[model samples]
Target: DVKVTQSSRYLVKRTGEKVFLECVQDMDHENMFWYRQDPGLGLRLIYFSYDVKMKEKGDIPEGYSVSREKKERFSLILESASTNQTSMYLCASSWDRGGQYFGPGTRLTVT
Candidate 1:
């Protein structure tokens, strides 16, 4: 079975602080993605990596960055978190176009 786990289920941060959200997958998937979910805006992709050290910007990448130094781990970095950036972050991994296995998600609050 494929398993994806996020470092935190909930996180709190102050405005302008840097934040790091981590995700790890056990399936050795070749693709990993980071997305942010908001009530009305729906799920917006932040970034994705097809392989180690390779990243591509997704729909909303203005305030976010990502790292995939290792095959099993992917990290999302918020350069400077803001109130508008507060949302539920989700990590997903997939081996092909079939489907993605998602993590529990991290609910981040920026005050």
Candidate 2:
């Protein structure tokens, strides 16, 4: 089974604090992505890693960064949490053109 797991299901934080969201996939996927799903706006990409130690910026990577030092793990770092950044964060993993499998998203609230 293809499994993508998020480290946190829900998170609450104060403004300006650094936050880290972690994800892991059981399958050996080449593509791992971080995205946030907001009401009306749909899912927007934050970052993605196609190979270990390699990363790429997506649509909304201003407040975020990603790391893929290991094959099965990926991490999302939020430099300064803000109220505007409050949303559900989803982690996904896939192979070449493989359909994405989602984690049980982390709902982050920046108060």
Candidate 3:
């Protein structure tokens, strides 16, 4: 069974703070994705990595960045946290066109 783990379940940060959210997948998936979910906008991909040391920006990548140093770990970085950046952040991993397994999201609150 594939298992996904996130560094934090809930996070609270002030504006302008740098935040790091980490995700890990047990299966050696080749694809990892970072997405943010809001009320009306639905799931918006922030960034994704196809392989180690390779990343691509997704639909919304203005204030976010990603790193994939290992096949099983992917990190999401928020350069400068803002109030509007507060949302439910999700991490998913997949391989060979199989469905992705998502981690328990991180609810971030920026005030």
Candidate 4:
């Protein structure tokens, strides 16, 4: 069975603050992704990592970065959070061509 967990279910941050969102997957999947969900824009990919220490920028990568130093853990970093950046962040892991397992989303609010 695959299980994904996020460090926080809800988070609040001030403008310009550095924020970190952590995700962990137990399945040892090779692919991990970070995405943010908004009302109208839907899910926007922020970054993805194919393997340890190997990351690629997704659809919306500006002001954000990612780390995958360990196979089971992936982290999303917000360099400087802004109000517009507030959204529900999701983490997912999967094998090549396999269905992705997603963690409980972390709702982030930047004021």
Candidate 5:
């Protein structure tokens, strides 16, 4: 089965601190995504990369950035973490149109 693994299951950060979240998929899928899930808000796309070294920002990418230098790994960086950025972050990947497969999640708390 395909799987996605995130660096941390939960994180605690302070305002204005820099943060990094990492994700890796073993399925060798070409498409990967990062999103934040909030209560009643569902998944809001932050960024997605279709291929290695190529990426595109999604609906909400203001406070976040991503890197995808290799095919199996993608990293997300928060230049300056904020309370509003404290949300459940998800990593997902898929092949072609099979639909996104998700990681368990990373719950970030910022104060």
Candidate 6:
């Protein structure tokens, strides 16, 4: 079975703090992605890595960065937390052009 796991299910931080969200997949996929889900905007990809040390910025990568050092792990970093950055973050992994499986999601809140 393919499984994706995030380090946190929920996180609360004050404004201006730096936050790190971790994700690990069991599938050994080459592509990993970070997305933020908002009510109307739906899921917006923040960043993605197709290979180790190779990353591609998605539509909303302004306030976010990603790391993929190993085949099974990927990390997301929020440089500066803010109220507007609060959203449900999802991590997904896929085998070369295969179906993507997503983690439960991390609900982040910034005050």
Comparison by lDDT, 4 against 5, better one:
4
TM-score of 2: 0.98
TM-score of each prediction: 0.98, 0.98, 0.97, 0.97, 0.97, 0.97
lDDT of 5 by residue, 1-111 (tens): 898999999999999999999999999999999999999999999999999989999999998999999999988999999999989999999888868899989999999
- Shift of residue 18 alpha carbon in model 3, Å: 0.5
Instruction: List the global CA lDDT of all models.
Output: 0.96, 0.94, 0.95, 0.96, 0.94, 0.93
Give lDDT tens digits, candidate 3, residues 1-111.
899999999999999999999999998899999999999999999999999999999999999988899999999999999999999999999985869899999999999
**Model 2 ranges with Cα > 4 A deviation:** none
Residues 1-111 of candidate 6: C-alpha lDDT, one tens digit per residue = 999999999999999999999999998788999999999999999999999989999999998888888989899999899899999999999978768999999999999
Model 5 off-target regions past 4 Å?
A: none
- lDDT, model 1, position 34: 98
Q: Which stretches of candidate 1 lie over 4 Å from their true place?
A: none
**Tens digits of per-residue lDDT for model 1 on 1-111?**
999999999999999999999999999899999999999888999999999999999999998989999999999999999999889999999986899999999999999
Query: Taking the tens digit of each residue's C-alpha lDDT, what string does model 4 give over 17-69?
Result: 99999999999899999999988988899999999999999999999999999
In model 4, which residue pairs have backbone atoms overlapping below 3 Å?
A: none
Name the 10 consecutive residues with the lowest summed lDDT in model 1: 92-101
TM-score of 4: 0.97
Colliding pairs, model 5: none
Query: How does residue 32 of candidate 1 score in lDDT?
Result: 98
